[model samples]
Target chain A: MKDKDGVSGVDSSSSGVNRRDFLKVGATAAAVAGASSVGMAESATAASFNPKKFAGTTVKILLVDGERDQEGIKDKISYIQKTHGIKVEVTALALGAQLEKIQSVLHAPTSEYDIIDNLGFTVSGVVGGGLFTKLNDYIANKELTASTYNYPADFPAGQLDYTSRYDVAKNKFGGKDVYLIPGMHSGSVIMFYRKDLLAAAGIPVPKNWDDYIDAARKLNTGGVSGTTMIAANDVSLILVDWYARFASMGGKLMSGTPGAKNYKPNLNGATAVRAVQHMIDCAEVSPKGVGSFGFTESVDAFSRGDVALMLCWSTIAGSAFNPATSKVASKIGAVQIPGDANTSGRPIRGGWGLGIPKNLPQKRKDAAWMVMQYITSAEFDKYQFDKYQTDPNRRGTYVDAALNKKYPYLKVAGQAMENAKMLDVALIPECFELVGEAAREFNLAIIGSQTAKQACANAQASWEKILKRAGHLA
Target chain B: MLYSLGISFFEFDRVAGKWNFLGLGNYKEILSDKVFWSSILVTGVMVGVALIVEVVAGVSLAIFFGQKLKGSKFVRAILITPMILNPVVVGLMWRALLNPQWGLINWFIGLFGIDNPPIWLADPKWTLWTLIFVDIWQWTPFIFVVVFARYQALPMDVFESARVDGASPLKIIRYITLPLVSSAVVFAAIFRGIDSFRTFDLVYGLTFGGPGRSTTTLSFYSFENGFVYYRYGFASALSYIMVIMATIGFSVLLKWIPVRRNH
Candidate 1:
């Protein structure tokens, strides 16, 4: 697929990352990933780093399927075997089954996987419970690390805090201690719209929730619906769509302290009501049966030119910018989720992280680290992003000139990730239950079965019940 | 089985990796849980409605094809197609077909001059019935095949004597045919009843137990708690409650059917 970028999307010859740009990317990565001035400066030079240190060792990886993760790894397996001299085996399963598989693998007498990629939300339960090996010692060892391997700098700081680093003693997300590295992909919510349609309609790019609704109403044409969303009674309803609007509208999600069993939900607040009501308003302009639309349907409709706007994860919706998958491929534009006049859009951070199970033998764990380093490297981040559009983890990959030229959404997505907020409820093991209950109530409201206020009240009640039952609320 | 049953009495805190004994607390919470009771009603409605329709439709088809009419042999082979496909695949296929905007079903209905059609999988009023319809579409064939086999094996003299006695086709079916085939109907109903009681894959693939627990069967709820929520003890207790209900319900049904007199 040749575009104005003058490079083939699949051309292995043209790796978009130059060494000079990559070095610069490493230095400023932390700032781009959203944090105070940070660096991964250790005194090790290139002479100490060896790629083939673990020759002939086999390392197995487990990842959740359908995220375009396994395909890209399979493409590079031969290259890895030749360059790194290690055999890499990857197994990807559907999300629920993979979570169950991780449970069994972790508890097994001998761990089944050398490196396990976990869902970001489940990190609290797994890593917080001390089921993963901390990687601080391994990262500090020059012989085991690549000289240029930018530990937490190259990844988003919010993602690092959520998935990579954990304070086991305090049972909190962020600390200096490292346990995992963001791999496969990391993403945040961004809005996709039809540039041509908005321009033709003279509708300015929506900068706030009110503008968004007005634009959606104006764009609802003879053949096209105005907008779509993940309004289904699925977890994405809460995480992807609703949370973006809620946070951007200045709604605080939880209050009190998690450790004291006094966590309180803010679902019944004014901002929460407005956020849900905004979804209820958008449903009027959405496609028929939009209440049942999951991530697939909403994105598919936007790609097909049947819907004009969508708020979706950058990872799943990247296919919409590809010419092969999308009808409006050339006319699409991506931007951070819109905020009202007073605040900024802060979509919930969504992605996975790779870590070694605590039960694995040290030898296997060491071998797994070598493979893990390569998969999370800036070079491979560009390689996979260029080839498969698996959302790049490194800010350098998102900012690569050739990639930006090929896919215009990269710059906006890069900006979006730097500001993405973590779902506070995800720090608890009952997150799925909490998110699920809210999703059901919001879905009913979106479908006109209940009022937005009633939905919020019900959701608040349900979340409180669940939190109290789980001993996270008094 | 016993491992899950034992786990039912103990809550497994997944993060802490410990099983704390709850004894009857799990069962007590489950009984009081509104979602659990709603799921019970959903499952009850699904099994009751789906079984009756499947039995009636299955027996009618069995009686229709039992005559050995011409081309019935060819049609019979095609009749069981829905039952052959996996329930998940069937659910997905129906979901696509029921898609309100561009689905083939709605489009076909549009040809009749109706601009708007019911959102089959999304609407609370329609989702459960739509599920029951899909179940009947798939499992009615099971009842047909089972009853058809029984119909074929029945002695022809009894049917022939009834015909000679001037009984009409409908009368013969009601008086003689239904009585002899009552055994197969009971067995097929029980078999289909159990499968319908434990409906999970269909709900997972189709509606995912909502617009708000509208189609969440007991089995689907058990799966959501065990797998999605990681509430192992809660899910296990729910499953046991379903078991107790199924045992008592089927036992009463068995006595009510009077299958012994047919022999």
Candidate 2:
């Protein structure tokens, strides 16, 4: 149904369920319905739900636009609007500013964002604060399906696991059932190298920790700096990368046992100590004045051909490959970061998701889920890779012939994805700050300002104190 | 009366609705926080050092330009130009200048036979002082303009009377000029002190309180905790503490120096 003002006329009955009733009914229905509906809805929607036929529906999506996805999707906005008769409004914000805006909006009871992109930092908080709708019901009820959505299969299993939480200790639905759907699978901190430079230096592409050191040394002799990583306040990205490597080294940041909130400083353990020493060794070979490098500085240095290698996100891959933005574009090659002996087989994974705001009307929540499902469908995964150069999170997309042909490096990313490990840190609300503080001390240690033992000890002490304040530490 | 009533109402709304009223809880946390205390020490050092440099340099420039010379007006205009630029812009300009790899400062330092110039903003120990240097460069112009105006407005007769008494130029300046402009000096100190306490834009743009929190000031800490970390209650507590400190500092300065009247 469509109103004169262009708002979709959702059934009034859908709005009657209160918060308590929905919580009681939603979880039970979701679990039972999810298994049966996986293959049920493919034909029902594909035959009838035509975007061109549906008119007068407006969808508001909040997105961070500075990255490749936003730039790639901007051109398609008009096409989607014209075809579907759906008016889509995208609000582009700086990454940090977007987080603050979303948090402030979520904190207010009557806030009005229908759909929001979910950063890893805000996912737990948003869910715990009851600011997001659980999508398990929609997925289970067959209201949303793989055909209707774009990225349903593009997501990696690990990403899906991270997005979904189990309240195993309490044997509950964890307050919400899968609050987010992985929209863009662009999270791995890939290492970008100058292929030409490596060839000139007669060095092989680094595969493991030892290879990485040897390559760095070879690159250093040619007047080219070894590698660059973010060490600034926004060093959370790099810290996550380091955690992935530590996990590869068989060092767990926290025990995965459910119900246990307090975590010990396993970072001081042998595996973690070795990993930190490896990072310190890498730091010594990094360019002069690497201590103050943030995401922008590190990326700029790599793109400008000032550094031999940059350990950063796949999200920046498109920019690094563009001839206009990068001086070393044609010479650049992608590879998974080298893991330690224990983690040599694993790769690090990082990315964000899309979810409905819990405060919206039930009809709006359903509509938002409809939009999310459509955007993450198989078709859209191809569209994203073709247009935006974003890596799909799904295993199938890794082997897509079209994708492989257009972006040969997707194979490298796929290999990294196969070995990808999640950050072994706690997913609690204060985890970001705790990780940031620890990373700062770790960076200090890497730059020779503090010893590895001293850095880990100091980080443990600081983290213990922070966790104590948050009631997570005994 | 109206203004007082409005302020009271605003204060009531803020206390009742905005703040969580954790009372001593946040204060206790701040007291025990090593990061908080370390930031306080850093802020104190920065403000103290920058203030001394700004006042001394600013006053000297003010006195220098107070003398009549050809193109004096043009020189005065150029000297006060930095006061009009935004703090963020000033910071970015200086960050570019101080960049170790490509910076003009490092380039200039290389010409002086110093082969290895220190990474000014990248090193933990030098970041705070480097930020202070940028602040002094930008805000000292404000002080110079204010003090120069004060110098221009000084009575010609008082200096003439001092000169008739056989007082040297230095003596006349020390006794007559300095005493008359004491309020202006106090004004500059108090204003600069209050502004420096809340300084964020420049420091944020330049150092981002980094190289391991070496340049993190109290205001920057408050912003990070409140906005970045989403600890609204703790941030509110920090703001209140800053307010009390600023009020006390201003009150003492006001009491110490009475405003000059046009007798």
Candidate 3:
């Protein structure tokens, strides 16, 4: 079977099914798709369509701990079991442990998990590794999904390209093949500001990096920092903070496409340096230890009304508008991160997806997919958002009138999500290496240890070395 | 150890889900890698400075507690409080205390009319030393507890004779007390040295080996490569190199630092 990246010659030993058998099942499944009774199972509401079809059977799922994705499942496990008659067993692990678990289990002859969640950044590594079953046939089977399920169209178009589809033949993303389903939560970096502070200081919302810096300086008084952001030794600095600024300034992330011999990071360009310089300028108006702050610290500063502005992940900073958790709950405003004349601010695409492992039995895969369909459906999307305030993945929920009224930022955040740009370098498995090297050097620049030019040059050198070692650079 | 050693010769291809033979390529690259070398230097400095400070301070506290003064038991209990806390918790506790904006440490310093204190965790120049200071605070009590027990077991006859001979307290400590506790100090040093040499969680909780990789220890560096980058072969090689360096360093330390054992 072909992997997500289109790589052939997968070791069938683990799946206990040779290529011939795999193709036979796929061909059979494809031919008999319309005749299957999976989606056609009787139900009261298509959204709550649960059947006892897999009665007394168990489907094991793996979820990332500490995320709303896991919380949603734990909250409704009993309902799922009672409705579907499929016992749901969940194994939730922290991000690192979860990834390791995926790797080890998928490689074993008989995998333990029937369903698993993949972080967006690791999609290329996990899903691309041919660990998950090709979900296109399952999705195309009308009997399994409801008429209102609207699998692909329901999710943001960009997320489907980034986190769900993989061109197995071309070994790249944006492929026609669907191997994963984007759900649980999805978000991007957006600017969050104190409306009260900005209005009091007579400063309009920043439209570009220059204006952002100017507003920060003007608002830096009265014991409040003008702005704050993640600049510490963190990958988010690269994904959420630096990349947003650099991309907004029209700096491309990669010089060449994945699998190209000349693939390298576009780190030392003029626009990249200018973006770094902008971060340094803004650092002057940030809190005293802003250089060391991550999302939590920066968001806490904004929540406590100590910072006037911030560029944060909508999922993290969403709490700032909750009365119970924030001091500025009624006083803050949200917008797309400011962009330059050449480009609109396109924050990094961020989210997670759920998929079925390829090694699972046919019955388990069906049961797991049924559970997945229920959880990611539009009905459940609205349900989760209302109950847990999860970062909504379904487009309908993002533009929901009630949600928009209660959370004023919903409309703006929805726009940001629809237009979010993913890093080109993330299409390859060497994503963390590229981002981590640049994050370290840019952090040095933000902390005043090096000039922007020097930091960019250093990052470029490191990227060159890493790409060469990864065989992406010649 | 053997499995890691085996993987050191093969490069893991994440997309292909297979391993490629690299022989000594990982080791060769790591030898010239500046970041690996810097991590080694940071680890060395952290272990050396923390070991010395903890040993010295532990002995001083041990001597003070050995005086058997009023409320000595309560003070002794307080002295070993930090030793029992997890290293990660200690790192997090100190991270808050060192926060330049609202931390108690800077606030206490501000009471003396100072403003604009240094950003301890953010500044590359001071981050390594700050980590060392935090490690010392947490582990120093381990040495004190070990040596204090030895001090309590020491016979009183020697101290009585020293005082009768008109030996001052300082002289008595320098010649008699120190010699008796040297063995305990050496034992504590070896244990603390090994523990500090492989420090990962503390650094992860504190600065995450950063600002600009200023505080990246060897273990954390290996973790970044293996888990974050998925360069299994290179990470395995790097870890083995650390093992070799630590082995040789400890061997020499055990030889050079003599501990006298009194009958």
Candidate 4:
């Protein structure tokens, strides 16, 4: 699988971070796993760093499955034990089951996982509810975070706001209180387009919603459809598709604060209706029966070169650019989500957060922080991104010159993170309910069973009823 | 059951980690919930249609196989293969086959000069029927196996006497064979009905209860509220309601059928 650059997608050979070389000695050295052989040479330099401080202690972690979370960490567990002197055990679960597991453990009188990965969608609910221990004290301590680790500054500010800090008292986002740290991955949606098709048709890249629709219509020729999207009855439609369009159009999702008595969704507004209508129009140029597509179908369509354009998660669909698994790898180009005239396209922030449960013993919390710092270090961030193409949360890794040459999409995705916005409804615990209800209604609209107005209106009513039942509305 | 019964009396707030007593509030909420009622309607249509098709197809196959024709044993073995496959695998296989763009079902139909076949899994009008068809395809063999065993065990002397008495084939089957197979048929119907009523895995793998709740069943509804929404109390009440409904339905069925022998 050769790319346009004539480099094999599987080879990190020319770059100093050859996976085979790293795997050869990964069992003996910890810092080597984090820092590539050609980079800073941290394994020898950080020799004074004592990993055996808590040698006998074992820290249990719960990680979400998929996209290099468990794989990245599991590959380095032996190295971590050697360096940190703490044994690591990881239990990974599917997205839905992970949420249930977190809820069950946090509600129990005892703790099962010393450190847990918080699914980004549930961060506001779990963190706002005070399920995790505050990590500010640990971050401030040199021994826990290490001397060279830049602490919070290493991660993008937007990611920190979305995954780390939560205002427990106000039950809001963007407070100074840090409860979690960005782990294994952080990502947002970006657009992937067929450069060859757009070039052949003499069409420019779409910059706004109106331009996007026009381009799609013109591209819907020959055997290929213009574009594909995830509008199936899945939560991703709410996250990646609707929210990307709505927020970019400057639509405020909710009018009131979470947990406020007057809190209500702004679902039936003009912008909301227009966004749904735009999605319906996009449906016209998509492959037949795309109304039922989830991530699998939409990504498969783009990867198979059956579609000309796609807007999808960077972690999941970013691989379509790799020649190893995609037919259009050399022909595709990626960019930040398209913006409208009024606002920039802000793809809903998506990722996992690492945190220690509040009920854990202090010693365990300290040991857990050690492991967290090691896995999330800037060096490890670059390592995993180069090895497995896991989305990186650190600013330094995305901007690394060597990585950009291999994966050009990283720069745009990193820019996307700087301006990304968290899903507003996700701040509340009933997030899935709001998103789920709206997803179903809008799905009906996409399938031509209802008008955009009718779908938005139905969604508004369902939201109001749910809010009232939860005592968020009077 | 007792634990769910208790939870039904309380509202468990998963986010705040608190539980409050609601007494019969959960029940009252479910009674007026539009989604709950819609789910019941969907479940009724799906179960009713699937049960009728499965029973009829199963019995027809059973009687055909009971003739003991050549290679009947080999054909019977092949017939039950779908029943043995995991429901998840079946759903996935059909999901591929029913794909509107590239699926074999539409492709085969297209070869017959039919263009633009209905999207089997996406269109709201067709999704429910498609699911029912898949259910029948997968579970009909279970009924066939049960009724076929009973068909083979029946006394041969009765059929001999009926034939000697100059009864026509249709008359013999109506007066003697039908009566003998009545108990087995009733048992199979009740068994298949209960299983169909509780369908979840297939729906999860198939449409995920949508094109817009058109394929949602009571079990799927209960699952979404409990696991998806984390509304433990409300979901518990929904489950208990389904339990009561199933019990009442079976009680009526038993009363309607005369399982006792007249002799």
Candidate 5:
């Protein structure tokens, strides 16, 4: 085929045109055309890109172990070394601690790992701090091929939106090409309850805020707390849950567009105030120490059969129903979070992604990109689901017969994904701290120290202050 | 001296690398922050309350153990056990013990005919006090050990002289014993005060400055702003404020300790 620029080809028959010169020119033209046609693809077959053959070279990765994907770090390292010829060192850190560690490392020039598994929020920090290599050139140069890369398409639109940068001028994402790959996506705030208990109480599983309140009140009657949620001073979990419930109630934390540094506070409106009030009411029926409880306390309360319902992550369903982990496992059941007046059928999405750190050497980055491709591939998603019970983030993986049988809950979780909204706080990093602080103030009101109105007012004031300090106030 | 010593370094170049020197602009921003002021007030209250509790209980325990009583040695060792355990471990253990649902404290409350026990850590009004309890439980013994050792080292003649003067036990304690041990008390308070101001591991491990920022001290606030939120400049400003507050506290404490007198 002729090049788009219509450059003339060398004469093959002329004796003046050496065979070698003709071949080199022909190859160079073909290469340039190929690179332009499909960005980030090298002229190599997927079958030949064997990561296992690069054994002597070691790569370090940081990942969080979700409930479903609790792969033993040793086994993963060993398999990568044996199969791909590369020695992989994986450090599986807890969710919160990992965020802290990533923030500290990214702030400095040199990073501890060749690759870091970061969420969209952390990726924003990495981007803002110029910590990650811009993949636009690499993608355009065909150094990273999407066909061989196997980027999962099953991640919800919100998850994709969260990870990809928004070019305000273009009003499009993934337009600048990929910066981070959606590693794993799961629903952040899922409403779970003891199915048996709800049935026994003659109350149906709640489908909306009114029903939820009624069910909680009924559950609170039998010496059991109505619902368990993270209300402690740690704002990340609390705000995620708050946003989930608020979205269900037709409220939003902020308005404008993603990656816009100057967004207005849409959370202090009437809808937001009502959402805060509902949470305060829920707190009344919660366990005695609900305000002080973090993730562990909330989960423990639900798992121990002391609480009738819990609004948490989809990853928590397995733990809540595991006999070893929960006393109420046999009676527990999972469902979508109840909707509020505004949002009658929306679930919140909370999970992280994999991105190339800017500080990595070019060769190391190439290697790291390969690893990300391998893990996020269709074959790997199957392996992850079958071996570890981790649900895949790809659409095809959700319908895979084998995965459905092994983890029936994934079907429900997958359904929740269709209605998933990215927890608003994750988009703005400072919002996490602000929301957490606001939630604590709300908790103070819930426990009767502060009135519900007072709590809302305090939260609005606090949130406004944070936005002002971040130069985002409208 | 500053140039020769690598330890006494500042990131002047890094600071000047990007932004203009606002000359304490960040500090000005911090001073104007209500959260900053609130954090300062919280830390002050926590330190003051914790110190007072530690001193009273510590002094009493030291005086009690100073007496020659049966099983006093065993009690002393048991009381000091909390200090030996890691602060994180101690925090977790107490969290379990004070847990509203399954904790022993709540279980005992049930025995008292109470329907629902107050969630010690969960209640905003009670959260700070709960942290205080944990701090006192862990560190009161340090004070006890110090005060007890000093009490034992007091010359026997001083008490004998008070006794010969027909002084009552209360009078002897107030006039003689108290004055002699005042130096040791000052030293312990200074050390403990500084340590308490920087307390992170135990409080973080226990409450994480939660139930609505009721338990957040200056250090916790600094951590949240710096690492969690990635506001390095703001965090640096908070750190400097902490340093100033600590320095002032130390200076005021040192004034009470007699530099010339060897106790």
Candidate 6:
């Protein structure tokens, strides 16, 4: 696969799937036609979708533990051995340990696992560093990928930019370069509400932040909290809760670039203060001790029928629709997050990506891509969602009429996924530090210990110091 | 240990996959960092309050259990259950019980006609206190078990002599019984103090350092920097400072609390 130059024999046929443009040509007008034209099935034209492309190789996949990333693949192990004729080994680890392992191995001369899953936030660190081989050649190589294996066209553009593509030279996400593929499941932040409660209160559904707060205040009664969110000192506090309001309200997170050394964070701006104030207002109408609520606490409260509204990652709160785990399962309705007047809802993208290491032997890299292709295909996407409830990364899966009829939230989650914005912090390695500091300061505001202005000012100060230490700021 | 000390002088460059020497830069940065100082204060308060309550409660229980009253065996066994449980589990259990809404604690207090009780995990005033209380609940039994063994092994002749010499029961207990178990009490206190000083998992499981850094102990802070932020140098420096503080604090404690093995 090697040419004179390029990362891992990357051909000159544009790093990104050119079909993205062709898919964009007709837009949603041809979505169904789009899915059918390029979408692959498990048993397709044998010449294009050969199950035995790599008949006698072993491929190992490293996946996250609790997200059910392994179950979909594990359940089909026998089929993989029989159909693909490749021995598949899967090792799943908890979040913290898995991230550490990814970092340690990404730089090794030879990678132990042929395929590794990349969390969206860690994109700038590992992928931007060019630790993974560029996959442009694989996507364009017809022999390697099936013709019916729809890629850039079938996946949402936001998820593609966030998880699949990278601009290594500029040290940012989403450019012409394609280093990874959105794998398994992808998700976005969506607003969840109680249909029963809203109907009883005669309150119209919220379309923006202003209407949202008004509805929350009016509905905060009868032993049910108006809203709950990730207000604790967790990274999700910033990524999910604060960013939803801030981005929707037209807040710009930062300016300049890391290389220019003028990267200045604008946490103390008016929009930021307003977003924080909005959360504090919601906390007033929320359950007692809402300041201490993390994802589990917030989701549990909502599922137990004590909370009237919430904004959460669909992948996580999707369980709220199951009767076995939720008292309000039948009472729930989900929609895209509300935006302010001028702008639209722009929740940050959330999901993992699958990539091959740059240092892998050529044979394994080829084998890994063959497995990745089948796994990310629209056929597998449908099966995984149908079987495991893992979120779907493909747009076609979201709009699948049959799946949407069964899981109503699929339609709303798809719309949000298309509109989702990648967290600007994901562009830098100091991301966790930046988000963590902001989460703490805002959490203090949510608890009423600090005013919204003070909290924003504090976050501003801390972020600047971190940016300066990292030499990304003057 | 030596590698951590060495790593303290260097900051890791994640993208480049190498370390850049920043000799004394990390130390200087940590010394001026407000979060580090606040964590130190939190650790100090947690260790002091939790250790004192544990020693006092444990010694009191040991003395009472030593009386060998009816069913004391079963009660003693029940009292040490928290001690045997993992610290993280203890933290999580207390967090659930202390949850302001729908928690068993609030419900129980409500039945007593106290409608408004403290929000244990949320309020800054109570978050740290709740963590300390959980620590005391889990560790006080260690002190009880250790001191009880010594209390039971004490020679009977001494107490009998004191009673024979016209000594009141309370007086004999305070003057004679206490001194004999002083060594065991001192050992348990000092040991508990060090463990409490570097406590990490409880803080991680319970508060995550806070609604606003209210419960951020030094160890947790060090871990947040090292693992969460990937600021290895800063975390290593913070850890070294903790080692120094713990070494000196325990040294002074050992000197102040004299453990007399023989009367």
Candidate 3 C-alpha lDDT tens digits along A80-134:
7777777888888867678778877888887898888888888888778888888
Count of backbone collisions within predicted model 1: 0
How far in Å is the alpha carbon of A399 misplaced in model 5?
3.1
How much lDDT does each candidate structure score? 0.85, 0.66, 0.81, 0.82, 0.65, 0.84
TM-score of each: 0.93, 0.83, 0.90, 0.91, 0.83, 0.90
Model 1 lDDT per residue over B181-262, tens place = 9989999999999999999999988999998999999999999998888888889989999999999999999988788563
Native interface contacts kept by each candidate, as a fraction = 0.81, 0.48, 0.85, 0.73, 0.65, 0.75
In model 4, residue pairs whose N, Cα or C atoms come closer than 3 Å (at least 3 residues apart or on different chains), thus clashing, are: A51-A83, A51-A84, A55-A85
Q: Candidate 5's interface RMSD, please? A: 4.2
Question: Taking the candidates one at a time, how many backbone clashes does each contain?
Answer: 0, 16, 4, 3, 20, 0
Best by TM-score: 1
What is the DockQ for all candidates, taken in turn? 0.74, 0.37, 0.71, 0.64, 0.44, 0.66
Residue B70 of model 5 has an lDDT of: 100
Return whichever of 3 and 5 wins on TM-score. 3
List the candidate 6 regions with Cα displacement exceeding 4 Å: A1-45, A48-61, A65-71, A77-82, A85-94, A107-114, A140-144, A358-371
Q: Stretches of candidate 2 above 4 Å error?
A: A1-46, A50-60, A136-146, A164-176, A237-241, A256-258, A361-390, A393-403, B1-23, B66-81, B151-172, B257-259
Candidate 4: tens digits of C-alpha lDDT, residues B7-124: 9889876556679999999999999988899999999998898998888899889888988999999999999999999988999999999988889999999999998899898899
Residue range with the least summed lDDT across 10 consecutive positions in model 6 chain B: B253-262
* lDDT head-to-head 5 vs 6, winner: 6
Question: What does the lDDT read for residue A133 in candidate 6?
Answer: 87
For each of the candidates, the C-alpha root-mean-square deviation to the true structure, in angstroms, is 6.0, 10.3, 8.7, 6.5, 11.5, 6.8
Model 5 per-residue lDDT tens digits across residues A216-264: 9888977788887777665644445666667767776676644365666
Point out the worst 10-residue segment of candidate 6 chain A by lDDT: A3-12
Please state the error at residue A352 of candidate 6 in Å: 1.7
At residue A24, give the lDDT of candidate 4. 34
